[model samples]
Every structure is written in structure tokens, then in C-alpha cells.
Target: MKKIFSFNNIKTLLAVLLLCMGSAACKKLIEIPNPVDRLTPKDVFKDSAGAVLAIEGVYLNFGYYELSQGAIFNGVMTMQTGLLSDELLTSSADNTFVDFANNTLRSDNNAVASVWSSAYTNLYVVNACIEGINNSTGISEKNKQQFIGELKVVRAFYYFNLINVFGPVPLIKGTDFRVNATIPRTPVNEVYQQIVADLTEARQLLQPAYPTTGRERPNLHTATALLAKVYLYQQNWSGAETMAKEVLGAGIYNLETDLNNVFVAGSKEAIWQLSTIKSQLYQTVEANDVIPMFPFMIPKYYLSTHLLDAFESKDQRKTKWTAVSTMDIDGVLTDFYYPFKYKNNTAAATPREDYMVFRLGEQYLILAEALARQGKLGEAQPYLTEVRVRSGLDEITPATQPAFLNAIMKERRTELFCEWSNRWFDLKRNGTVNEVIGAIKPEWQSTDALYPIPLGERRLNTFLEQNPGYTE
Candidate 1:
């Protein structure tokens, strides 16, 4: 396969649209020879129009890479299953890997390997686009700066996903992908710093109003929302609370009239979405769709006995995230579980709606948690209740921070599963991967918190380093 970073040659971009599940068709873009157009940043970003087009490209590009971008989450609920069940975490390791049954992992495992290549490849593409825009002469000056900043912000979102998944990463901030065959890991803190800087700049450059307003494209709101989240990841509660509330007050989004509709698209609740059209959607609903919790892939994700038990009887989430009963062969009724949110697989070509990446309503919950953590319980209650009521659960009156935060976390799980990288991030940011989920999943390792840098990436770029504990 031709690697994406061969900047010296013009190649056709294989645009595989992730519109509907399993029903993708590829289109080739930029099918000409590569040329190094010499132009100052001033020449390109001089008009907002070019910058706008580039931003449009960013949202459009997501369909090409979103699903395969990160696969482990779709495949494994948590690393612990590797120890408890042999069925979980199956893939080509090219190494004698008995660790899953043993519940312990070395740095070189296959599950962690795919992510390093996938995410970095994505970052590199974004970087290439950023560089292309920076040097192009067709855009306006002010828009040029904003476009670069905005792209970095989105890139940071992807990088943060990498950092949380693969621990420390060799941070690549430029378009240059030329380096030796293997690289060493950079520190986690450094990765965090870069994400923060990108988001901060993004927030500054994005207009207060999103051009896709309340849609699933990165806009001023999503950018700020991410900054607050990154701050929370870093334990900057005050900053988290500040940014979270700013988004809340903006009033561009809502909690949705019905909680179920939040995932069903066209709901005013969406902030940003990963989208697909009808013809592009897959005809079959697989066991891996992010909706309704229990995945069809058995060990990859079974509703944790804990997760299954988390909801109260009236909680609307239970019916979708977990499948207590299902139909089997001969049309026999058997009790089992599968992802319910995206369970509808009979679309003609693909799912009609794109996966929502961010929603305005989600920030309300974030604000509730942030404010509650910062000692603003009274202000947090209504926001929390909006989601609770929408989800068919009664609101809680948390008198303490732990209670409030716990509610926020659960709400997020029930509301946002499979669309965003919420589950993984929440596990890391809350330090719950090892705690709330650890005992049942004994195979999880502190090191497994981060994905191992992919072997292919290691073999391709010397400048990029392998994440810790992995070997070439």
C-alpha cells in the first residue's frame, strides 16, 4: 500500500466515505502530480473565503477516516477482557501473545498497535492540509490565520485522543513526515501542552458563531468546549468551569426535546456530528454499532455487569445501551445484548444521519460537572436535570461534589456512547479505567492506558517514536 505522507509525488486520494455502515464507496481527489507552490501565508489566507473552504474541507474529510480511525474501542470494551476471555482482543499480533488470557500486556501487543498508525496518520493529513493552506496564495490573511488555528484545534482533538489512548506520543506539529524508520516516545505532559495550545488558539480564531452552527463541524463552540475538556483532563477545574459555562450561555444548542432523538440527528441538540447519507449507509446493522451499549462482538464489549446495573429502572438509557433479550435463529427469542442506539441496520444504502461528534447539549452536562467541582452546585442542578428529564430519569439534588461528578459521568455514558471518544477519555480523565472498571477486567495494565505506537508508523518514520514499552 502507498503510504499517505509521500509528499514528493502527486497521488490520488482514496476518499472512502463512512456514510453508512459497511456501504462505503471510494472517490479519488487531487489526482494530479504533486507541486510545491511557493506562496507566503499572506497570499492564501488573505480572504475568509479560502479559509472557509478549507474548514469546510475539514468537516467533509471526517467521513473518509472516522470509523477506521480508531478500531479498538469498537472491538474491545476494555483491556481486562483479554485476561478473562480468550474471545476478546483478536487481531494479527505477529507475536506470541498470550497476555489477553493472562490479563497482562507488554508494550508490543497488537490491539494497541493499530491506533498509533491510524491516529498519527490522521494527524499527519491534517498537518499536511494545514501546511497546504498556510503556503497557498488563494486565501485571505485573517481567514488564513483562523484556518490554521482552527485546523490545529481539530488536530489537537485527535492528538488528545491519541495521548489518552497511547500515553506519551512523539508529537508531530508540522507537515514533515520524512524521518528515519523508527522514533522514541515523547512525554505525555508534552502532548498535553501541545493539545492545550492548539485548542486555545482555535478558540481565539473561531467566530463566536459556528458557520455550521449547532452542526457537527468544528466551530467556535466545539473548540472552546474542547479547551475546557482538555483543561479538565489536566485538572484545571477553574478553567474547565469557565469555558464550559461560556458554551452553556451561548444558547446556540439545547438538550433536545427527547433524549433518544439526540442520537437520531437533526435534533437541535447536536453541536457537531459525523454524518452519512442514505445511499451510503450499510444495509446491515452489525454487532459493533455504537448505539445501545452491549456490542455484538461478545468479549470486545459486554455490558459490564456494573454498567448494566448502573441505571435506575426509569432511566431511558437501559433499553438502548443494553439488550436483555434478542432474537436468534429460527426466530427463537433469546436473551442477549447489543448496541441499541444504532441497532437500526435496514437502511437502503447507509444510515441517513452521520454520527454526531459533538452536541451543544453535552456541554450543559460538562458545565454542571465543572461548576459543581468548583463549588457551584446550585447552578449545576438545572442543567443536569435537563438531561435527566430528557433521558426519562428524574433529576438528582447532589449535595456533594462526588455525587454530582458521578452523575455527570453516568449521564455522559448514557447519552454520548459510540459517537465521541467519551468512554475512553472519561476512563482516563477520571482515572476510572483502573478503578471503576479494573477489578472485573484484570487484564488491564497501567501501561495499557495508552495504545502502543503502531508498528507500521514506527517502521516508516524515524522522527516519530514508539510509545513506551513497545519494541520494533
Candidate 2:
């Protein structure tokens, strides 16, 4: 049989397999014939170009409507979680935003299902890439390691998000559909261990410089930055501090002096970003989703009053990162604010902004928090100061450890809001979710910290357990 090895063909194969795996009848559907004339992994990897294209296919999955820029991972989850916490509030009749903003999310929510399915679907592609790259005899050893390293980083990224959102998600590291179809949730701690291991190996395997010219591809520093965050979440302060400092010391990135330019394409602050090149439908999905085209138009969501009040009067981020408008509510003209970090929403052929996954601003906060946790308050001051000074705020001088940590948490809340689940995760990790969010949202419960596992997923796989406080 003649073997076909092409980029489009490989992408189609991966997409079909992922679609099958994401279906309710995944087991039966996934048994369908492999595309490319049932080409073995060897045949696909035999051509170095095909192997590279296979990995690029994984990146394409990152930009999928359900995954990165769309409503699931980077866009929706970030916005809704902001609403769930305190960064945003519902302004429209969309039930999904209304449900999340009101702290009344259901397991059957389509947004919830999309996040769960898309994350795993992309993860399946990552595992497939790792397996094919490792088993390929045609590829050089160096090329194999590079591909495997990048895939490991992507896998760790998905697991990190999964564990954070669902508490203990099933850790699927292999491409065995039979086993993955029924895998149960792994312990949260165990999941962190796997993340650390993957990131550590990835950091070692990747080069200091990014593999690609842009920040879209993972590098040693990219792995280090993520690993630092993993360590921070795990309370491994020394590990977190060490890894964070390594990235900073590399001199590859710097805090973008102009706060407004941080999210622009080719930013100096970007450690890892997702290119919108593959997303032809929208130039910047997160921007187009959150920001309204006209000043008076009500956006799908708006910045919460709580977040608006959190910023100091002179803080540049409030002015530079958010947009203010006045809209008629009933007969009264009311003022509203929405996140404007991504300023461009036009559907131009070349994107003006990139969805930032990791950046120097986050690293600065990560290092500061890690240092503060280790009781190095004085040492942590400079890193925190760097971010604050850039935000046009004066340096803070907290007298005590608790005060310093609180400052770091507050800084994270303001600096990272609406970018990802930064505010939500910071609140959860700092053990102030109930005290902070509950005070603002009366419906806030401790159990609300973990989103409900999608109802459809529970029905499809009997082994999957529902999160507490959600219907099984």
C-alpha cells in the first residue's frame, strides 16, 4: 500500500481521531480506520517534514475555538472565572455568563462541556505526537527529543489547567484510547508531580532559545516558567523561586515598560504565547469576545465593580488595560468598563495581538510570591516593585510577612485579571476564596471552587465522578 505523509492529511487524521475520542460513543467511533492508508507511525515520521507537521497540528489544536482563543480555555474560562471570582460581571442575557456570574453553573452547561472536552481532545493529540515522535526510527535522535520536549510542555499545560479547574482530573499521558476512555481522576498531588516531571524533562530537553522565531513554541525558559508556577501552586517555594530566577536571569524577557503594549504581537514580555495565525475566523478571539466594537454597545461581560475599586486612583493598568463607556440603561445613561488588554478586534489577515499564555509580568509576581512564602520579604520587594512601577504605582513597603503576601495576592489580582484564571487561582491558592468571594457573592460556597465535571462526560464514562455540590 502506498503511504501518504502530508501536513493536511496528518492534521485531518488527528482531528478525526480527536473528534471520535470526544464523542459519546468514543470507543466504537474511535475504532474506525486510520487515515493516510493506515500508515504506521514509522511511515509518517520517516519524512522529517511530516513529523514536524504533526507537532504543528498539535499547536493548531491549541488555537481551536474550544481550546485557546475561543470560549473554553483562554477566552471563556478566563472571562467566566473572572465573573465567578470578582474580575467581571454579567451584562447581557447569555445564560452561560448569567449562570457563572451568579454562581449557579450547571454540569450540563455547554461552556463547561466544551472546556472539558476540548482540553482532553487536545491532550489526546499531544500524547499521539509524543508516541509517534518517540517511536519514529526515521527521525534523528536530536529532532526526536526536540519534538518530544515540546509535546511534554503542551501536555503539562493541559494537565495544569485541568487539575486547577476540576480538582482531580484523569491524567491521560498515553495515546491508548482503550485505557484513556475509562481512566478515573488522579489525585491532585499526583497530577502536580506528573506536571513537574514533564516540565523538568522538557526544560532539560529544550534549548535556551525558542525553537521557532516567535514565542509560540516552547523553550527551556518556557518550561521553567510553567514549572515555577506548578511549584508555586504546590508550595514548593524554593523550587518555584529557583526556576523563576533562572528564567529571569536568562535575559530573554523583560517587563514591557508600556503596559498597553504587553499583549501586542512580538512583545518582549511574552515567555509563551499562542499565535492567532491559524485562527482565520477571528484575529483575536478573546479580544473580540470581551470588547465591544462601539463605545455605547454593551459587551457580553463587563469588569466587576469590585475589580474597578481594587485599583488605586493613579494606577495605569486601570486606565490602559480597561475601557470605559456610558450606555443607556432603561432611560438612564450608566457607565461601564470592560477589559481592553487586547486592543485590536479587527479581522485583519495578519493578527496584531497574540494570546499570551505566560509572560514576564507573571514571572515577576511568581518570583515575588515564592520569595515571600520563604520569608524573604525584603528580597522579594524588587520583583514586586518592578511590576508595580510599570503599572504607574508607587513601591509598597509591607512591614510583615502576612502583609507582604497579601500585597502579592492583591497585585496578582489586578495585574493578571481577565488574562486567564489568575484571579480565581490566586484566590483559591491563597485560602481566601470563601472570605473574599463569599463576601461579594452571597451564593459563593467553598465547593464552588471546582467547576462541575461536564454531565455528558459523567454519562459517557461511568468511572468519572462528579465534583462535589454538582448533580452526578
Candidate 3:
């Protein structure tokens, strides 16, 4: 098998790609030999294998890499956003973690800038792939459509996170840095519209079956699954219900009976998972960072009191997904609980877990919430109960629509905690950020509902405006 292509200098390559934009006029964009070290857009999309390899690079970015500031998809969202919300508490006094936890984020926060840059960096690659695949004549027609569809799903996912985290952001559709740098922040609603459009198109072009051997790539249902989430976030209750119900009933996945199995690589519940590139050190960055070598050792990141107290009694997630560390504190044993969702810290010959991006569990919650919001309490109860029962909790009895919605949200807090900033995004989307975060954090402010646009980015692009409540 041919090795996956590597971007020797992504910046320089992107600059070259900018001049080689795919168009009728630019048809014979300078051709170079197919060397794996260097890949031009023309060389990349010249054939089906090259097209597939180009997108694989995008997936590689999401897995464990040696970058000092980790890529956004590679557990960055879970850690930073986890701190920004109440899901996690860190022992380290890093200012980046401190700002997020205290809700006093400055424009120059290194963490914030890393996230911004990482996301756009990946987005550029995705955009380039889309352009290359579309412009390619060597690749088969079907492959081109599916590849573009997959890229759109990824692009939508990035923009969705950007919209949620930064309120408004530049929606870069192409690989031209000059144009992207000068683009102003698009409104949140407009960004959502674009996300909806991308997912909508993606759903049409993708096939139902996994494009690859594993669930590493997005399928037709994957696009639908994400569209469901997009609808849920937009409060399109009916649309959310339709999309979630389709995935839930498509017979593709199930809720893992053992909560511990839910996050394992290629688990039955995973709709989309990010495959890890095995290395000598660890299978996943999240596991290596969050899990201590010894059971009795305190972890770098542990559950916050707010999150620890949220789980109800007999909740298996509290037992199965979390672990306790008993440390000797001056002859006194102190216990600290931390997330144990990803169990493989050491690199095994075969990985036990892949970074879970989407799964059947979230779909059930989405379906239940969508139904409950539409006053279909009777219909929604079963979906919510399925998840609860799987976790060894008693099934909830029927309740009013509002009560059902509340229960669904509460269940989301416990079931999805520390996974992907679910708690933080939920707090913001549900308008409970100030109430929940403010009760715990005295530094919380209404303006903190959206993070500041990174200061360095704003300085570079004067067109980019600062989010309210941040200094220019």
C-alpha cells in the first residue's frame, strides 16, 4: 500500500495551492512528480488514491500528533472547553487553563489562539481537498462526489464548533489565505445557515455504508447524524427529531450495554470515530493526559465538584466512566475522581479506543430532546429511558414536556460530561450559562457567553472585530 501523503510545510504548500486554484483558466496548474513528501492540488486529486490520501491527512490532524499546541479535534475541545465550563478542574496552574476555568479569558490567551489557528489550519486543508477533488478529471465521478461530501461534513463540523465557541467567525470556503485573512466574522445565524446547507448536500452525496473498513469516515448516516445536531442547536425541534430518528432507526448502531464499551474503537455505538495513528507513547492524547500511571495517583485533570455532584445514585456512568485516585497527603489518604472514558493510556499493539466524535448515545438524547420540545412527551420518554436503562438507572416515569426536557438535559450532563465540551455548549445553548456558571464562578460575566476572538488574529486582520467585552 502507498504511504499517506505528508504536508512537509503546510504553510508553503497552501501558498502554492493559492496560486494553483482550480478553474478552467488554471487547468494545467504546474505538474510535479507524485512524491509523497510534497503534494500539489493537481497531484493530489489526479487519481482516486491521491484523493483519498488527501482527506486522510485531514483525519491524521485529528489524531495524536507532536505539535506543541495540539490540533483542535485532538482532545483540545474536551480540555479547554471542559475547563471553560464546570466539567473539569485542573491541578496545573497554567494561565491558559486558569483563564478558561475562571471565565476571565483574555484576547491573547495562548489556548484560545491555538484553537483558532488549529481549526483554520485544518479547514484550509479540507477546503483544498474539496477544490482538488472537484477539479479532478482522473478520479471517477462517484468517488469525487463522495469525497467532496465527506469534506463538506468535516467543514460543517468545524464551522459548527466555531459558531458555538466564538459566536461569529469568518466562513472560509476556499484555500486563499489572503482572502480568508481579510474576511470579517460572519453572524452566528448566517454561519448556521451555511452549516445546514453543507450537511444537507453531504447527506445527499454520501452512501449509507461505511466508505472505509471502519467508522473512521463519515457515511450518509454520519451526515444525517450531524445535521440532527445542527438542527437541535438551532432549536429546529421538528427537524432535529426527524434527523435523529432516522439515524436511531437506520439499524446501524446501538447503545453499548456497558458504558465502558461506548468509547472503544469501532464500538457498536460509534457513528463516527477518529482513528488514531499508533505511536510509541500513547493511543490517545486524552487518555495519556487524563489517566495517571497508577490507580492511586492523582490525575492532572479531575472531575469538578459541580460535575461529580451532578450524577445521581446508581448511575453506572459515575462508576464505569470515572475513576478514583487515593493519594497520600501527609499521611492522609485523599480521593480524587477523574474521567476514565478512554482507558488505553499505553500504546498497545492494537488500540482499544479511538477518539469518539459521534455515537448512538448522543442521537438518542437528541431525539428525546427534540420530541419533548415538540410536546411529544409520550414519544420521547422511551428514547430517553433507553439511554438511562443502559446505564443501570431506573427508567423515568412520564412527566410534563418541560420536565422531560429538563430530565433530558440533566441526563446529557451526566452521560456526555467531559466528552466534547457537551456541558459547556449545553450551558450556552440552553441560556443557563450565567445561572449555572455564575453560581459557581464569581468571575462569570454575561459577555463571557462568547469567547474573545484571538487578539493576534484580530491584529493580523483588521477586518476581524473583537467579540463584545474584550479590549481591542
Candidate 4:
């Protein structure tokens, strides 16, 4: 088995806080080694062809986004971020699983640090590509501008994931991070502005197309899906619904008849995703702490008691997605049962599956939630039912806005599992984070929502400050 370092230690937190993009990136993001300087932005952008190489590196050096426990690790980009996540603790190798009810800290080892750093590195790379596109005049104007749009959406995705995890962060649009360390944290609102800005520009840049095999690269549909999510996260139901409906109406995507196809690589539903192209997927997944043991690895969370009880007994998802176990009086299995369909012991068993960064199924759900919140539950039913019927569940019939919203959240949690930290963030965004996990985890106070920015960055850049309730 490939061994992943524990993020539980204050030391491993170092990796969790920063990322090593390339030789240049390693120096800017990490401290241990003197990173070898491979290429400079000026040297890279000296020609239009040179700029293409640098842009390719953005995809080439992509890290495994889904850093879950080793098992379901490869593509879980949204695995765990921030302090509210329930991942493995420090000394995780010694302790197999954390006792959620008894643990003192609500967080596992991962934090928003590395995610924030790596995304900026990506932004810098993309922005430099735009710089080259603007400067190197030989390339066709249409091609250069199109490349810029593509690069911006990719950068916007990076920033969106970072802002989601780290709250307000430094927004750099160039390759001067060494000196730019002095730049202070941008307001969270401003960060969102940048994300929205990048994506909006991408919508106009990307061609209206659907790519079946190469979902890693952003397409028009992917941009649309991302805009839908950005609006939903910002609580702009109308904006969210409008973009979501566009994707639904666009003939580019649909829920796969086979639900299992959703998680497998090369599925039709994936919009834009992170692929293990230039990097080894094994390196990223093995380092995960929480992904291997719970849900998929050992199945610790067998549908929260409330969730298992909430579903109607006949609900197809409950039967297909979850399982209940009963032991004989002699402590032997009376009948074996399991609760989920996306089982890939091989995901932990081996690093093969590419994580889905964005997919069409999620877009549908985003549409459902956005529409339902807009007091259009009846209109949202078809999107909700498409996923439900595919999962073998009966069509949903949410009557009121509140009921529809609650069902949408449940649908999100159930449909999107082991992919990202969406489960944790969903509760936070819905204002039910404390209410639901508070009793299950007494350590999860309201202050625990955002992560404590690494103390190192605070010293490196005095302009930086910790998130609320975290000590410097």
C-alpha cells in the first residue's frame, strides 16, 4: 500500500498549506528546498509557441484535487478543506479512525493553506499565458483571445476553490509572488468578484461545445455550470437558475442511464475535471487522511442516523446508496448489506480514477436547488427527478420552497459523495452547519467554520492575518 503522510501533525500541515507547482512554484509555495529555476515568465513568453508550453503546464502539473483518505483519493479535489472538515487527526497512522463523537477538534489534518497557495500558482501561470498572448503578436488574434478566455476560466476555477476554502485570499494576476507576498488579503467579496469576472469572460471566450473524453479542459458548458455554482454559493438564486437552465437546455449533457458511469473516468456527465495528466495520481491519493476510512474505505458514516431515518423506506436511493447491517446473537453477519453504489476499493486499492472537478449531474442539482429556492419547486422537479430516477428513487414532489430546499441539500449530499468537501461546506452555507454537526461533534463550534491560516504565512507576510477566531 502506498503510504500518505498524515496532515494531523503541525508539520504535515505544511504540505496542506502550500503546493509545489513547478521548479519556480516550489520555491514560491514551499520552504524546505531551494527550488530549481526551470523557466521565467519572460523566457517562457518570448514567443507565441513558448506561451503554449507554459499554458500546457497548467494542465500538466495539475494536482489531484480529491485528496481524501488513500482509497478514494485520486480525484477528490474537494476532499477536505478548512477546519470544519472531519478528516483524520495527527498521529492518524496510530489511530485508524477518529471517534467523531468524542474527538476534541472538529477538523482533521487538511486546511485551506495548500489549496490557497496552489490555486494562486495556477492563476499566475494562466495570467502569464494571457500576458504572452497579448505580447506575442504572431499568433492569430482570435486564437490568442480564445486561449486567454480558456486560461481565465481555469484560473477562475482555481480561485473559486481557494476562496471557498480559505475565505478572502491574496489575488495575484502575474508571476511576481515573491515580491507580491507583501500584498494583503483581498476582501472575500473582491475575491468573488475576480472569480465571477474570470468565469464571465470565459463564457464569451469558450466555444459552445461538449467534449466527451477531455473533460479536464473547460468548455462553454463547464463555464456555464461553474457560473451556476458561483451564483448559488453567493445565494443569487435567479442568476444560479438562469445559468443552470442554460446547461439543461443545451444538448451537451444529461444524467447517465447508469449511475455508476458518473464516477468512472470518461463519463458523459462530467463537465470539467482535474486529470492526472503530467503528475502521478498515486502521490496525491495516498496522502489523504479521511477518504480511505469513512464512507468508502471502511464505511464509518452509514448515512447519519437522521438521514437514514429521513428517507422514505421505499426511496430508491436509500436502498441503492446505503445499507444496514445486522449481526447474529453470536456476532456473525446475519445478512451482509452496504449503503452506497460508488465503490472502488481500487480507488484506494490503486490510483487510477481521475477525480471529477465538475460534472453535468451536479449542474442539474444546482439547477434544482436554485429554482426551488426561487419558489419554483414545480419547475425544478424534472431536474431533481432525472437524478432520482437514475438512482432508482421515485420522483420528488417538493411542495413548498423550504421543503424543496431541504430536499435539494439532501440530494446534494447523497448524490455527490467522496468527491469534495461539498458536504461540509453545504451545511455551512445553508446555516445548518452548527445545528446538525454540533451535537454529533461537540468540538464543532461556530468559530470552527473557517480554517486558521498557517502561522508561517503570517510571519512571512505581516500583511496577512488569520481568519476570524484563529490566533496569530
Q: Compare the candidates by lDDT and give the number of the best one.
A: 3
Candidate 3 residue-wise lDDT, 1-472, digit = tens: 0011123223434433343344222323334444534555676678987676566667655544333453667787788888888888877788878788788999988778877877777777787788878888999988987998999999999898888888899887876665666788898899999999999999989999988888988999999999999999999999999999999889979888988788878799999987664445777788888888788777878889888888888999999999888989899998899998888887773547777889899999999999889898889989999999998899986557777888999999998998777899999899998898889889888998787888888777888888889985
List ranges where model 4 is wrong by over 4 Å: 1-43, 46-49, 65-77, 81-112, 210-213, 276-352
Candidate 3 wrong stretches, greater than 4 Å = 1-40, 64-70, 349-351
Error of 1 at 421 (Å): 3.9
- C-alpha lDDT of residue 46 in model 4: 54
lDDT of 2 by residue, 1-472 (tens): 0001112323434443444443332333244455545655555466566677666656655643333422244576788788888888877788877888888889988787877777877776677667777777788887777888888988898888878888999888775555666888899999988998999899779988777779988888999999999999999999999999998999878888998779878999999887765454566677777778788888777888899999999999999999977998999998889898887776573437888889999999999999999899989999999999999999989999999998998898889989779898888887988998899888877899998988888777778898899876
- Candidate 3: 10-residue stretch with minimal lDDT: 1-10
Q: What's the TM-score of every candidate structure?
A: 0.76, 0.91, 0.91, 0.76
Off by over 4 Å in 2: 1-35, 64-73, 349-351
The sequence of per-residue lDDT tens digits that candidate 4 reaches over residues 313-423 is 655656655444444536654432333434443334332345566778788899988888878888888888887777777876877888888788778877764356677
Best of the two (3, 4) by TM-score: 3
Candidate 3 residue 157 Cα shift, in angstroms, is: 0.4
TM-score-wise, the better of 1 and 2 is 2
